[model samples]
Target chain A: MHELTVDLGDRSYPIYIGEHLLGESRWLQPHIPGKQVCIVTNETIAPLYLSRLKASLDGYQIHTVILPDGESFKTLEVVNRIFDGLLESRHNRTTTLIALGGGVVGDMTGFAAACYQRGVGFIQVPTTLLAMVDSSVGGKTGVNHPLGKNMIGAFYQPYCVLADMTLLGSLPPRELSAGIAEIIKYGLISDYPFFEWLEQNVDRLLVGDQEALAYAVERSCRNKAEVVAADEHEGGIRAILNFGHTFGHAIETAQGYGNWLHGEAVAAGMVMAADLSWRRGDISADELARVRDLLVRARLPVTAPDDMTPARFVELMGVDKKVLDGRLRLVLLEAMGNAVVTSDIDTDLLAETFAACR
Target chain B: MHELTVDLGDRSYPIYIGEHLLGESRWLQPHIPGKQVCIVTNETIAPLYLSRLKASLDGYQIHTVILPDGESFKTLEVVNRIFDGLLESRHNRTTTLIALGGGVVGDMTGFAAACYQRGVGFIQVPTTLLAMVDSSVGGKTGVNHPLGKNMIGAFYQPYCVLADMTLLGSLPPRELSAGIAEIIKYGLISDYPFFEWLEQNVDRLLVGDQEALAYAVERSCRNKAEVVAADEHEGGIRAILNFGHTFGHAIETAQGYGNWLHGEAVAAGMVMAADLSWRRGDISADELARVRDLLVRARLPVTAPDDMTPARFVELMGVDKKVLDGRLRLVLLEAMGNAVVTSDIDTDLLAETFAACR
Candidate 1:
């Protein structure tokens, strides 16, 4: 097992990445300070991993809230079920909530932990590659509103994140591709060497090679942990981590969530961002092409939904959280391995990129 | 006018106590860093002070979400209205949320702000004495659940708290009494001198003496601020601040909320706590009598509702946020002026106090 710490000072926690780490009491027990444990998993995951996890938590007073699986279920109302189970089971403030599913389950469970009795201990045991590489590492936990994705949430850190690569053996092909989108994001944002490595080993990740998957997860977490530690609240440098997210959120909001996977929309959104960067004379056409090529090789979408228009995208993006003082702050590439968050977007260029990408 | 700071390190904010501070832009504008402002108030408060508060932000883009007035409306569904309004108006992450009512409005707005786009700027403009002296000053913000009172919330601080004493001119007598319950709590928990002062000036406060009310508000805020600063997340000493809350929450939950005003429930709960303290030999019967006498003088309840039984109270209190590992941690008065949180409660004595108080 490989251990990486997201150093957030007093709120710092560890991310354990390796094969067959789940069902190990050693990895899960140390973080749970109290005797009561509430494991929140989705219906799909419960059928597969719940019993194994429950077995690991042998002595504790255990409770489980199994939710229906999907991005559509990521709402305040759905998250309330976890709250309902918690209150019904009489889970106390000291009780630790274990989020044992994909990103949706983790987000809702982490958010439930955040608001449950004004914060409690949370452990993220991410099951999907998407969660292992992205959502589970950062403290961004929340639900979606009809108006926007992650519109209601909190920057609440978890006690620890346990990412067992063996869990990915059962992931659907599309979900695996979706996870690679975020993996590619880490390379594009700040790590040039990792970006180059991904170019050579993108095939290895696509085929579910455990070694490559572990390396990508660990590297992505390391990059994310650094950004989060420096700016836990997204005050400055952290906004760069949202590279492609502003456009991706608009796509997700426009397509009605669940319809388009977050990473798929982000895959396409990254292309639009790169195109805009090329138009702004920040990066070469070759670099923009290379960005799209990596995502294409990983079998992720490279364009917005055919029905979405530039006007619709603009309207939906207006309500995105990234907008500040009525200006849309787009995270664009200054270079292949660099990202910059700027509100000063050339309207003509944005329209051009939207038209081209769609 | 008096200014007191809730020293929560970087998240610290000032509590301004004065006459006519609400209609002034000078106090409101300094805290609002963005151009957009969403004023969240209830129907009763909107008709009264919303316009006055709006008038202060002459140059800013303003929005209002007027909720139905009452504790019954303090829920996730109602709080969603604030989120809907914020998104509908395109209030981004930089926008500030101004809570322009009592504790219900404050709690809902603060929770909305805390969750809106993963936290945003929030300011508390309290109109009720209960809010001004207690809820608004502390960072405890959330909506109540059917299972328990304040079972879901965030410890998110406001940018600043503005308590306009003049706003109290229109407060109902019963509401004023509710506010007094918390002020008396400060005296019993940490400030005996303030407790003694309340004994002499309770009548003046009841009659709306501005000078007496101002002194009480400042003193209560100081006491709360000190506790909150020392332990912001209620680790140890801060639990004492919830001296009457566990018992009080049971009363509120048992009555189905909004029936017994929060302060009234707390008043009765404090009396029961004092009775329990006496039984435990922590305080004298005379001290318990003094506690009851002060609440009665303030026109607050000195006993739990006649309909509630010990078993029901026990059931409700068991689900309270204070419960740790199924153990009920009651904040009992160690003396007239000091409080201690103990899980080692004598159940027999607890039932005796519940029987005696009811």
Candidate 2:
């Protein structure tokens, strides 16, 4: 197993990556606060892996909440279901909540854990590549509101994240592509060397190359951990971690949350942000093209949908959590492996960039 | 105005107590993050004081969300209404939420502020004595669930709390009595002198004597502020603040939320806790009697309803937030001004205490 630390001082925790880390009871037992544990999973993953996960939590009072799969169920009402399950099982603040599915399960379960008795211990057992590489690491837990995505949430850190790469073999082809977008995002925002490495290893990753997948998950977690450590609350330096999120979140909100996967929207959003950077003379047009080429090679969308307009995009971006005061501060690229947040970009130029992407 | 600091370092805020403090624009304006402010009040309090509060926020883009009164409305659904109103008004992270009602308003607004963009600035404009003396100062914000009261909440502090004594003049007699129960609680759990003062000045406070009411509000806030500053998350020192809450919350939960005021249930619970303490040889019969006498004088209930049985009370207390692991750690009195949390108390003694209270 490979371990990466998110050094958030007292709030710091470790992320474990390996072929089958979920099979190791040692990794999860130390973090369990009590003998009672509840594993929150979804319909898709439960039938396949719930019993396997239960084996690791033997000798503990285990309960399960099986929710329907999809972003459509990520609501306050769904979060309440998790809470009801915990309360009915008589789970206390000391009880641990094990999120045993992909990003939706991890996000909703983390949110439920955050608000349950003001917060309890929760562990992430990511079953999808997207969750393993990104969402499972950071403490950014919340559900989407009708007006926007991730509008209601808390900056709650998990006790530990168990990202077993072995689970990636079961993910659908489309979902696997979605996960690669975020994996590529880390390299684009912070690590140039990793971007070059992914270019060479893309085919290996697609074929379930175990070593390549492990390396990708470890690097992604390390990059995320460093960013989270510097800005636990997304104050300043942490905003860089949201490179494509401004455009990405708007797309998610405009498209109706479940219509498009988060990673797909973010993949398209990154290409748009890169083009906007090129328009601002911050990056070469070649660099922008390279970003688009890489996303295309990974089978991810690199352009905005035809129906989405600049005006609609602006309206959706208005409600984003990143908007401060009234100005829309976006995390734009200066170059690949580098980013900056700016509000001084000309509105006409941004509109033109959006038009080009569409 | 008299000011007391909550002393949480950078996150610390001041609690301002005085007559007509709500109209003091200078004190409120500096804390509001931007030029826009949203005041959240209920229908009962809005008609009486909205104009004065609005006059204080003259330059800001002021908005009001007048919700229906009562604890039943303190649900996530109501919290979302405030979120919807803020979004419609183009309120961003800079927009401040001013809670302008009793405990229900303060809780819902504070919770809405906590979850809006992961959290925003909140100012408590507490009009009811119950809110002024307890809920407004501690930063314990949440909405009620069908299964429990305050089951969903966060310990997010306000930027400031405005306790305006003048507004209490229009409060109903029953509500005023309910508020005094909490005032008596500060004395029961931590302050003997405050208890003596209440015994001497109960009539004066009931009739709205400015000096006596101010003293009660200030002392109760002082006690709460100190406990909150010491243990913001109810780890250990803060649990003492819930001296009668375990039983009280159970009563609120079983009787249906809004059937009895929080303070009323707490009043009856304190008497029960005191009786239990005496039965366990933790306090003398005279001390228990003194506790009941003071509650009776305040026009608060000193006993549970005759229909409530020890078994039902046991079931209710089992689900309380204070329970750790599987043991119920209740805050029991050792004297008029001292309390301790323990799970080792005899179950038979507890049953007798509940029977005596009934």
Q: Quick one: best DockQ, which candidate?
A: 1
Q: lDDT score, residue B185, model 1? A: 94
Docking class of 2: medium
**Candidate fnat values, all:** 0.98, 0.50
Residue A290 of model 1 has an lDDT of 95
- Screening candidate 2 with a backbone cut-off below 3 angstroms (N, C-alpha, C), the clashing residue pairs are none
Mark the regions of model 1 whose C-alpha exceeds 4 Å error after superposition: A250-256, A304-326, A344-358, B247-256, B279-282, B304-326, B344-358
Q: DockQ of all candidates, in order?
A: 0.86, 0.58
Worst 10 residues of 1 chain A by lDDT: A318-327
Model 2, span A1-358: residue lDDT tens: 8988889888888888897777779999999988889899999999889988999888999989999898878888899998889878878778899999988899999988888877788999999999888888778888877766678887788899988888888988888989999999999889989988988888888888888999998998898888888788877888887788788888877787767788899999998889888999988988888889888988889888888987788777663334534477888887879888887667777788878998
- Tell me which residue pairs clash in candidate 1: none
Among these predicted structures, which one has the highest lDDT? Answer: 1
Give the TM-score, chain B only, in order for the candidates.
Answer: 0.94, 0.95
lDDT of 1 by residue, B214-279 (tens): 999999999999988898888888889888888898888778777898889889989988899999
Global Cα lDDT for candidate 2: 0.86
